[model samples]
Target: MKLKRARRSRRGRIEIIPMIDVMFFLLATYLLASLSMQRLDALPIALPDGKTAPLPSAAPLTLSIDRQDHIEVGGHAVALADVGNAVRQQLHDDRKVIVAADDKATQGTVTRAMLAAQNAGARALLIVIRHEG
Candidate 1:
């Protein structure tokens, strides 16, 4: 039997064009994702330098308003009418109150909580908001 010469197989080559296309697609996707993460209308806030500031005499009181208009103080739920009394009970020499209201919370609810804090003799009131990126 006559032996036939074996043909050499073609070597596989890496396609740089396809690799470049894939890299560009990934870059564009990441760029768009980063752009969308930015908040356009977010207000810039300058925080106080704590190095020279006096230390707080006491921890700040945290009060929260939920979307359902429920009021919470120190992780305990309290009635809207009783919010002032509850805050008064927790007040010490420092009467600083921080109100954290949900984005979906109604304006009336937030206003009521703030009023309660004021009625409870809070000297300073601060609203807590989520920091935008």
Candidate 2:
């Protein structure tokens, strides 16, 4: 009896289970990371109602924070550490410091700068805001 040759099969189909699992794991990781991030501060702000009194000093020493997060005093960019000294020096007799911060400016910068101005002996701290237009 002649020996029958066994039929040789080609390469078996590749399993996609591992690839699918990897994709799923990566998707889950990204979703979790995205969900874990905390949103920016949106604290409640109440505007003054009724008759508003004028500031003690009409003209105030201006500390501006642009969108780029640069600190400027009296139209001059000043370092964060030097803000207090600069403000004080600029306003020898003045008692008010007005903070004009862009909406895109970092909150920490504005807050810290304000504190610095106060520490530098600003009699009044006025918070000013501008419209996008």
Candidate 3:
């Protein structure tokens, strides 16, 4: 018989532990980044629900109150006394006015505007809110 052929023990494939370690490291990194970006939002307001028909898209009169409590309509500053007369003349019949009040403004100011709009014979008075944005 010929000389016995030399045979070496076979080596199996190595387990991929480094791949699992990399996957876990990537997961941790994403989790930490996502947590850092988390932020709180403002309180929610509930809108009324009903099966109402849509209103026409008429251009609404916008009234805004600044931090100093000054009132402006259509980007023009006007005296509080003249608001009703002015709105009455400008608005057409069957249209409502929009009052946009800032957080710094008092409730009375907004209420006064609404009351004025109503007194001027506005069909409806709507209070515009920041939530609309």
Candidate 4:
């Protein structure tokens, strides 16, 4: 009469909280698909409506304009008398300038591209509307 058996050795585990919730949902879906594939320097306008503001913190300088008026800045092809020396060589220290015309552009080429971004010092001249809602 020989009967004595009892063996249960469970081993094999790797849960890490659902692998850290699927690596935070694939890092939040690769940061919302790389922030919706960002890459819009400027140009391609039709904006006019207005009332939106609030967008500083540096990185403004766009200054586009189309409808045959031509002229550009950050996207190159600038002329209109060198658009104030291409907005003073893309002013740094955050002079802040946007413009982005072309709602049939020609209020004297959007007021001469906002007076050439205030003669290039551009103390701040944002103007790229289109919100009227």
Q: Write the per-residue lDDT of candidate 4 for residues 23-71, one digit (tens) a residue.
A: 9999999999999999776778788887886675656778888888887
Give lDDT tens digits, candidate 3, residues 19-127.
8999999999999999998742212222323343444697576666655557766556666777787677777655677666666667787678777767877787665
> What is each predicted model's overall lDDT from 0 to 1?
0.75, 0.75, 0.66, 0.82
- The residue-level lDDT of candidate 4 at 110 comes to 76
* Best-fitting candidate, scored by TM-score: 1
TM-score of each: 0.55, 0.54, 0.52, 0.36
Please identify model 2 stretches exceeding 4 Å from their true place: 1-57, 131-133
Candidate 1 C-alpha lDDT tens digits along 6-118: 98789999999999999999999999999999743222222222233333656577787777777787667888898999889887577888777777778888898889889
Positional deviation of residue 130's Cα in model 4 after best superposition, in angstroms: 0.7
What is the C-alpha local distance difference test score of candidate 3? Answer: 0.66
Best by lDDT: 4
- What is the alpha-carbon lDDT of model 2 when measured against the actual structure? 0.75
Residue pairs of candidate 3 with colliding backbone atoms: none
Q: How much is 70 displaced in model 2, in angstroms?
A: 0.6
lDDT of 4 at 133: 83
Judging by lDDT, tell me the better candidate of 3 and 4.
Answer: 4
Model 1 TM-score (2 dp): 0.55
Candidate with better lDDT, 1 vs 4: 4
Error of model 1, residue 5, in angstroms: 77
